[model samples]
Target: MINKIGKITIYVNDQEEAKKFWTEKVGFVVKFEQEMAPGMKWLEVGPSEEEFTTFVLYNKEAMKAQNPSVSVGHPSILLSTTDVEKAYEEMKENGVEVGKLMAMPYGKMFSFNDQDGNNYLLREDK
Candidate 1:
């Protein structure tokens, strides 16, 4: 049985730019990177190098060419943080497009967008 989340695939117009946004803005580190072809690459990023789950930044155009029926839109992802306030402030200070924080029934949470306009939810892990 599958017991853990391994990787999440996110399609983007430009992989390099997406990598920069995740690494520089979101503070994720590059977990892996390999050339898939002459100009395409298999790139992965996560909160830390030791994290098991990763975000796989794939090329939208290439995926479309490979499989016309493949969905290239971004997936709705919920990320956890120990401190919502600090995360919100850090993301804002890093120039990330972030939404206003709110006190949800579950916890304090907020949303942020990547360079490709992919939205992700960040909730406090209390």
Candidate 2:
């Protein structure tokens, strides 16, 4: 009964800043954005128009208040890239904090941190 992954929520201190980081720094496009409530806004961003899954940038404080049991910690996300070296260099040029590229049995990969200090893995599938 399971189809495909829909969306992943990323709780951030400032939604606007997160959006900028993803779009400007990470090179993702804004899929959707709208005012959900008085103080809350819904924002969805992804790598491309055809991408099935997207990241929803939500307000951290608002989410925590809405559901105390919900985990607000950073989620580990792994992204695929066509060229690990190019991706790594681009991220570094964009001022993103990234780790050195490593060679694994599977492929080449690296880690980078977003503005919220959330770490994400970038790998070139072999």
Candidate 3:
């Protein structure tokens, strides 16, 4: 049986660039990176200490025919921050394009867009 939601896969244009963004600013750790089928590259980045998330970006043209999502824009990478205000501030300080922090009925949240136009949500209930 499926015990939990293990991983989510996203496509990006530049693996290295995405890796850096996810790791450095987003606080995930690189788990594995290498090449894949048909001259395409594969990368998986996540939090080293705990289980985070990952996205794999392949070269655009090669992946385009498949209508892979990355060719159009970045892959969504959602995150949860304990302190929404502080988190939004840090993102702004780092030059991250984040939407104004908003409170939701379920929780507090803010949307952040990456270099590639992908929108990610930062939410907290805890």
Candidate 4:
């Protein structure tokens, strides 16, 4: 039985650039990285090394070449944070493109874009 969600794949134009964006700008750490081919890699990054789930940054062109039917578009991902306001400020200061912070009925939330223009939502968990 499926007990937990594992890794989500994110198709990117440049794996290295995506790694730098997630690690340097978004405060994520590289959980794992392996060279899949001569110039391709299987890269994973997450909020921390201890995080249960990680994002796999796959090369879009290579994926398309392997399977034409596979969607290479970015998925809509929602991430959680302990303090949305602080995270927003930090991400902004780190040169991350962010939207205005909004207070939802549940909590504060905001949207941010990666280097490839893929958008993701960040919400306060508590």
1-126, model 4: which lDDT tens digit per residue?
Answer: 998779999999999999999999998999999998898788999899788899999999999999999989888899999989989999999999999999988889999999999999999996
Total clashes, candidate 2? 0
Assess each prediction's global lDDT (C-alpha) against the native: 0.94, 0.94, 0.71, 0.93
Put down candidate 2 lDDT per residue, 1-126, tens digits, no spaces.
Answer: 999989999999999999999999989999999998899999999999999899999999999899999999988889998899999999999999999899988899999999989999999974
Show where candidate 4 strays beyond 4 Å.
none
Count clashing residue pairs per candidate: 0, 0, 1, 0
Better of 3 and 4 by TM-score: 4
Q: What stretches of model 2 exceed 4 Å from their correct place?
A: none
Q: In terms of TM-score, how similar is model 2 to the real structure?
A: 0.96
Identify the runs in model 1 with alpha carbons over 4 angstroms from their true place. Answer: none
Runs of candidate 3 with Cα error greater than 4 angstroms are: 37-39, 58-60, 65-77
User: Which candidate model has the greater TM-score, 2 or 4?
Assistant: 4
Give residue 12's error in model 2 in angstroms.
0.5
Please provide, for model 1 over 1-126, each residue's C-alpha lDDT reduced to its tens digit, 9 standing for 90 to 100: 999999999999999999999999989999999998898899999999889999999999999999999999778899999999999999999999999999978799999999988899999997
Per-residue lDDT, model 4, residue 66, is 91
TM-score of each: 0.97, 0.96, 0.76, 0.97
User: In terms of TM-score, how similar is model 3 to the real structure?
Assistant: 0.76
